[model samples]
Target: MSIQTSRRALLAAAALAAPAIWGRDAVAQIRRGDELTVGIWGGAQERITRQFCATPLERQHGVKINYVLGGTPERRARAYAERGRPSFDLLYLNIFESRQAVKDGVTMASSANVPNFANLYDIAKIGGYAVAFNPVTIVYDRRKVAAPMTSWRDFWRDDLKGKVIWPTYPGAQGTSALLMAAKVWGGSESNIDPAFTNIARLRPFAAIQGSQDQLYGMFDQDVGAASVEFGSFTRKYAETRNPNIVIADPTEGQAIATNVACITTGTRNQALAEAFVNLHLSPECQAAYAEEIYYSPTIKNVSFAPELAAKLILGEAAVNKLVDFNWDLVIANQPRWSSRFTREIAG
Candidate 1:
């Protein structure tokens, strides 16, 4: 079926299910002692979620929450392919995958149980499928680099050649990095030629498919001078080892690379899934997770911890500077760009 038709059907289903699960009293039909399964990313995010959301949820609702960890899109797709017998009720996806997941019937439509839906920044409500968990920022070692490394333009400098590291292409973080380059080089759209040209210039410094572990290791060892990584990573790195490490707000802008939560369409425990979605958006949950993980909170009135708040990219002013990326354009051209990058830029 077409995506619109599917969305309409899901909306209809949600409308029908709402009153049954959440009447005027706002209580779901899920009985006490029942269990709900949630699928989240395995590492840091999971730890934060369990500490902030899961344990509290179980205590409050008397429902056991089974936490499952895996690669977000792959696991969600596998659940859908199983013909609606979803192994997990909720899934965590990045922005791009959240869009595609909703289109693919992997997620249910948003419901009223998600209380902080109104608290979201406009960007967090994109296509009504997912919400932002944090804003990504540019990071550098202040002591090692004498000049202020404020923008993508700084990475292209001759002085940093063969000393920079970046994430792999086609990922949102990598795509945003490319868009940042495009913005600096005068092609902010998905034309990508200018971005590739910039990539070509930085090819000598490039490290492909590098994980956070590898990048942090490199930074610790001083093998790489700088990298464009998630704000959370930067904040944690700064807090733990390098007080000299600094996050920059570019004159051009920064992207809020996000981890979004969505309820699956085929969940056996719809109420529980919706509750989990609600928990994710709650001010308490958002604040707790933000402090623990150093990700920016999406809830409007909530404040992150002082140290984390300093690192977060909150408010309209910061959001305004971000590239209004065309996801459709990027997805359409990704293969072409990937092929060209492997041949020309990587060569």
Candidate 2:
């Protein structure tokens, strides 16, 4: 083997060995019925996590998973508030939030703790252990629009004037959509003036596609096109909810929004938390998440049937093609962007 490959092998071996060496002691900590709290989202996320990560860890370790299920904001707040004495052993955040958490020292370096970090795609390792990625792209009603939309520019078509619904301001989808708008125009992330200007021009939106339910329900109204929505939702909605819905592969590229898993700083059950994260990133859990929710796996080894693969954003090549936001800029300018969006676009 090459020197680098040999070194990587040694590191992986050591990572695997560390848990095993201390697991006997860790098992005692857990087998005493200690609760390892996991702050996660509700709905499909909660269901899949329970089935794949929590139940398996609980069964194997004889510990209970105290699930704190809610939105990311609440979970993030808890992580920040309880920094030195964190209640959440494992906290789930979006890529942006995860970065901020790491910077603020609210979260531990996931690579140091998560052994499966070695097996994931390099892109997925950016913020933390990004378990799944939901591509943000354009979704349109096939029946309402005469032609299939191919680019982000289609969102601004005269025909789609009153039919297109923008995601609410400060939301991930909306933030991503703004970046896309700026890019396709003559601007970039640092120069976001064009995005706001163009968004204002596309006035009298049909409705705000805020939540997942709202995104699905908007199609029944005058909504012919979504400025930006999750591709997984669009694909699933097309199959299960609305046959007329179609996801547009924009020429500019799709934004990658991810569900990142992080170990909170000062986690009491560090070993168990690492073990849970390891299992969460395991092939079985990753596959289940991809198959169940249509979110693409972050790990490189997980595979899907051809039919299912067609619906997902798979492989390293495809992952590289995704439009990555300047999250540092996005997060920093959020307040100003939100104010501008409210006064210009939403007003």
Candidate 3:
């Protein structure tokens, strides 16, 4: 069956099974007087927390959740500098930063107590780290082009010169865009020079800096024909009367980005924090959050809403085709890469 079909089947099964799934475990773990603090990015992250995490966690566990909002890199640095006296107990960070944070000792090793750690998809539990969310496929404005655009190579087409708006240098997604360029030009984990050369070739077309909101605005105003942006952000944009916009999974393979959750070393509430992670990975929680926020579900058994399922790039087969990277290398090499990128492209 197609991914869409399987997703629908899964969602149907989850909806039918949710009440039974939450029956005893949730109540046993959470108490009425207990509270937990979670750190996440503002805007959409906050929205997801309110709509998905907070309400359900409160209802199921009788646990009150307090949210602290900031960019992951900044918040994580502060947490580590404070040396276990972090204001928030749980943190939500993008994959590369999450890996870096763990390496830096900002995050603690995950506890087995988180109920569904074993139930997570293999990729979600990289080593002992748990991915909290998945970004959707890249998107474009269909009205700006006629032919079907299929891969990252399409962005560099000579005919579409000076028409692409890209994220700023050093940004993870921006860097991913560069990696996509490398992949298209035959660069792999062992080689990246050709990709850098290819990017330099497209320097004339690049928009070096812009906020997500600004990128969306450029698309709406026809300032740019396309951009590589998160699926959820594009979907939200499409909902705001930009019916001409559409998402396309590149023929080569879809790229998937993750946000992760980990344990902290000095937590006084280790058990509670672990429980929260467990709840986050539960099928009920995954389905609820996926349906509400339009992100792909990470828990294997949880199902995405039909619309979201259709939009997600990392379906079963697609997941296998995803390119894996050494995030530590990427983080370490970021400065050098950014410098070269600025000198050649942004300068």
Best by TM-score, which number?
A: 2
Better of 2 and 3 by TM-score: 2
| Cα-based lDDT at residue 115, candidate 2 | 70
Model 1: lDDT to the true structure: 0.66
lDDT of each: 0.66, 0.78, 0.65
Clashing pairs in 2: none
Lowest-scoring 10 consecutive residues by lDDT in candidate 3? Answer: 14-23
lDDT ranking of the models: 2, 1, 3
Q: Candidate 1: misplaced stretches above 4 Å?
A: 1-21, 24-28, 127-132, 304-307
Model 3 per-residue lDDT tens digits across residues 1-347 = 12344444544443332221333455434456677788877876676445534655566556677877888777777777866676667877777766666677777655445556666666777634454445434567776665667888987776567877767767756767777777789985457787788877775663654567778778767887777777666776787669877776787765657777766656555555665566566565555555555566666665554656775544456566665677777777788888887777777
Q: TM-score of every model?
A: 0.84, 0.90, 0.83
* Candidate with best lDDT: 2
Q: Per-residue lDDT tens digits of candidate 1, residues 1-347? A: 11122334433332232222455333445666878877778876776566545666566667788887787657757666854667767777777666666777767655455655777777777643344545555677776665888877898776677777776675656777777778788886656678888778787764653566777777777776777777777777778887777777777766756777777776667776666666566555555455556666665766544555665666676655555677767767889877886687655
Measured by TM-score, how close is model 1 to the native structure?
0.84
How many angstroms is residue 111 displaced in model 2 relative to the true structure, after the best TM-score fit?
1.3
